[model samples]
Structures are given as C-alpha cells and as structure tokens.
Target: MSAYGFEIVQTLIVDTEPDEYVKRAMSKINAAESNYLAGLVVGLRDSVLAFSMNVPGTTSKDFLGMVLVTQYFVTMKEIGALSESNPVFITHGPGTVKDIASQIRDGLLQVNTTQN
Candidate 1:
C-alpha cells in the first residue's frame, strides 16, 4: 500500500448549539494565521461539526499533526450535550480512505459504547 503523507480521512458534523468550548477554539483559530490547515472543526453547543482536509506529502506532516490533535482536544472539550463521551479522530492509509465513512461511523459507535 502506498503511504499517503497527510490527508484528511473524514469529516463529522454534529448539529447543535455553539458553546464555550467551541467559542474558545474558534476564537483561537480566527486570532491567528496558522501555517497548518485549521478551522475545519467548528465547536457549537448545539452544532458541533468537523471536516477533514487532506494535506498531501510529508512536508508539513509534523506541524499538521500537532495542530489537528490540538484542535481535536479543544473542540471536543466543550461539546456540551454531546459531551456524553469523548470524540474520536481516526487516521489511516490511502488503502483505507475509501472506507473512511464507515471507519468514522465505527469510531463514533465505539465512542458511544465506551460512554456506556
């Protein structure tokens, strides 16, 4: 299997209201010009949403990885009602990208299971 550098695996949209956590994260994203791709995830109390962007090649892989992970934590923290459990972020090879949707669904299911 060919190794893809940095690519967005999938995106998740949760319809909800904007909350403090979302607000804070958005504020940070807006306040700065990030070298790495950011702002894909919007935290809302009632509508938390996220979309993955594929960053090709290994050039910015390290930087992008850090930014993405940070965003994940920041956004997931204040999911409010949806905060029943922690959110999951999945990254896989190109071979598995075709099944990314299913992979995301399964990851969500796993999160739900862990919550209970």
Candidate 2:
C-alpha cells in the first residue's frame, strides 16, 4: 500500500433505525458487486465509523479506508457478516464526511513495517 494508494473492498450504507430506505440500501449493496475484503460504514445516531472485519479469504496484504454515509446503527452480527479484514474504526460527527484517507495512509505504513 503506497502513501497515496488505498483499496475499497466493500461498502455498507447503514441506518440507525433500519427503516425501509436503509433496509433497501443494505440489500442493494449486499447484492451488488464487491471486493474480496469488504469495508463497512457503520452509522450511529451521533457518529459514524468506517470499519472492516475479518472474514474468510482475506489476509493482511494491505490496509485501506473509506468514508461512510447515511444515519443508522448497525448490529454486531451484521458487522461480523461482512468483514474479514483488520477492523478499522474511526468515528466522526453526523452528516460530516470524514475521509478515511489519512487513516488508510497511516495504517498502510504501519502494516508495511510490521509485515516486512
């Protein structure tokens, strides 16, 4: 992973209340095309975290990040289902797009050193 490079495996747009719109969105993303290591955007009432979990067929090849949108909380079970990578959680204010660009930059640097 280079300093300016990051990969996005999967993306989940969740809602805290799990309403019709949120549910529909989740279903669509889940059914849509995704990468081997999926990234998740978990939303709470006041904050959101861009996260990735460890699942099957994924290894510590590199680190990446993404910005999560929407408003809703996610269950532990749901989080577990989609992630199979090192969990990266960064929380920020609601409705604000906190870019995980820096996180990915730092994380990859760390991974490179540790793996090497």
Candidate 3:
C-alpha cells in the first residue's frame, strides 16, 4: 500500500475552506510545515466581516484544521508532507479534521445476531 493516499491532484472545494486556512494549506504544501497546531478557537459571532489587503498572497487551499474558525495560533509541529494516514481536513465546516478511526474504520456492516 502507498503511504500517500491524499493525491493533491484531487478536485478542491473552495467555498467550504476559509481564506486564511487556504493560505496556511498552501504554505504547508509550499515548504515543510508542522503537522499539529493547538490554537485558540475563537467563536464567530455577529461581527462585521473585515478584510485586509496587506495580507499578501493569492487565495490559498492548503489549510488543515477545523476545531474552530478562529483557531490557528497554537501549532505544535508542522508536518512535512501529506501522508495516506494523515488527517484529511473536511472541505465543509469551520475547519475540523476527521478522526483517524472514523476516517478508515468504515465500510463494514455486520448483521445483528440473536442469542438464544
């Protein structure tokens, strides 16, 4: 089996991923970055959406987290490359990655057995 299952060549969902996350994702792919980040998850409330043009760079699509839309400051270790076992950041939602077990522990259906 190959270690890298996440073929970057796959189609990407733009709207679902935030602009910031996209930047980070691209950065991760661009250079060797950390794998895990434990950042503060700030809640998105009824606040006026602001934009800053100084934050240079084209729209990115390499984000990798989803605990909350505002959490991106506490990154433990930046992963070097994408692996087949790496957590796949869901295209939808704020920015949550699927659990390992939940990701691969699927496709199995068992029939209920009756015990006498």
Instruction: Specify the highest-TM-score model's number.
Output: 1
lDDT-superior candidate, 1 or 3: 1
**Candidate 2 lDDT for residue 100:** 44
lDDT of 1 by residue, 16-60 (tens): 678989999998986675523344333321122122334434344
Candidate topping lDDT: 1
Arrange candidates by lDDT, descending: 1, 2, 3
Global local distance difference test of model 1: 0.53
Worst 10 residues of 2 by lDDT: 63-72
Estimated TM-score for each candidate: 0.22, 0.20, 0.13
What tens-digit string does per-residue lDDT give for candidate 2 at 29-99? 87663532233322331122222243443333322222223221343336657767567564655433334
Candidate 3, residues 22-92, lDDT tens digits: the string is: 89888987554333221112222212112223334423221212222233222312332435456745344
RMSD of each: 22.5, 22.0, 22.2
Give the Å error, residue 3, model 2. Answer: 53
Segments of candidate 2 deviating more than 4 angstroms? 1-99
Ten contiguous residues with the weakest lDDT in model 3: 40-49
